[model samples]
Target: MLEKTGVPTPEQVKRAAPTEDRLKKGPVAVVECFQSIPCDPCQYACNQGAIKEFVDINDVPIIDHEECNGCGICISQCPGLAIFVIDATYSEDKGLVKVPHEYTPLPEKGEVVTGLDMAGNEACDAEVVKVQSAKSLDRTPVVWLAVPHDCLMKVRGFRRKGGAE
Candidate 1:
């Protein structure tokens, strides 16, 4: 969850979508994170000083979206299994969740998968629409998928068909 100094919080993200309508005509959250490891590449990745010190590297890096302009610098710089971008207004039918997936035998873009919540429970269905990877993004392979609006904050991970649990 992003913690922009003047943006929103986990609670605000829950209260009412505090995100700009990117699909329409505004900015959105670009989180390329997944794990809670001891790192801060995302913090250093941000030029607007959006992602700041985690206080503890083990803690998830927070993004100040107000200060952030949806620049995806942190998305490709993160080393842990954490980070993602959530456009709450991606679509009226569904919200797009771009998660930093690094599992081997990666799924193709347009593939469908089960979006798992924090508890690893299947909360909703997500389909990969875009796959961003390069020598720079490392081997993590940030996968961009679309999910339900209500499931955005709940989703934490995903598993493909016949994939590991």
Candidate 2:
């Protein structure tokens, strides 16, 4: 049920990965759903219809990555917190990532925090670019972080200052 390192397997990543061409178009959502759970919020959250409607409630989502504009809507709508928005074109030296955050003491905009990877390993320092908590989000805060361009793909989330959750 897990990859060699006890996380998502290579096949799972491949299934959820967007095409390199789509990624080059700018920021896009990456749905990391490896299991076929009965979920579809991501599909409807995408105003562009980039996430296809599931034939069955239990079916996994398929991304039309080209249609994705990286609006970061699906990031807060996903119940599994599996959707990530990556923008490699944010700048020449930085990248942007929008991640779902449910923890307390949410980092403020412009604040610096430690970035962590999927396995909770420290990746790099990240700056909070924006914090979206619109009423439509239903309590799930979507945090946007600016990280080093080189660590863009490696960063999955952020940690509070002083190693706090």
- Model 2 regions lying over 4 Å from their true place: 1-6
lDDT of 2 by residue, 82-110 (tens): 99998988888898988999998888899
**Winner by lDDT:** 2
TM-score per prediction, in order, is 0.71, 0.91
Q: Whole-model lDDT, candidate 2?
A: 0.85
**Which clashing pairs does model 2 show?**
none
Give the RMSD in angstroms, all C-alphas superposed, for model 2.
1.9
Residue 11, candidate 1: alpha-carbon lDDT: 59
Query: Global lDDT of each model?
Result: 0.66, 0.85
Worst 10 residues of 1 by lDDT: 16-25
In candidate 2, how many Å is residue 63 off?
Answer: 0.5
The alpha-carbon lDDT assigned to residue 22 of candidate 1 equals 36
Query: Looking at model 2, which ten-residue stretch has the lowest summed lDDT?
Result: 1-10
Write the residue-wise lDDT of candidate 1 on 37-94 in tens digits. Answer: 6766677777888777668868766666667665455665666454556666667778
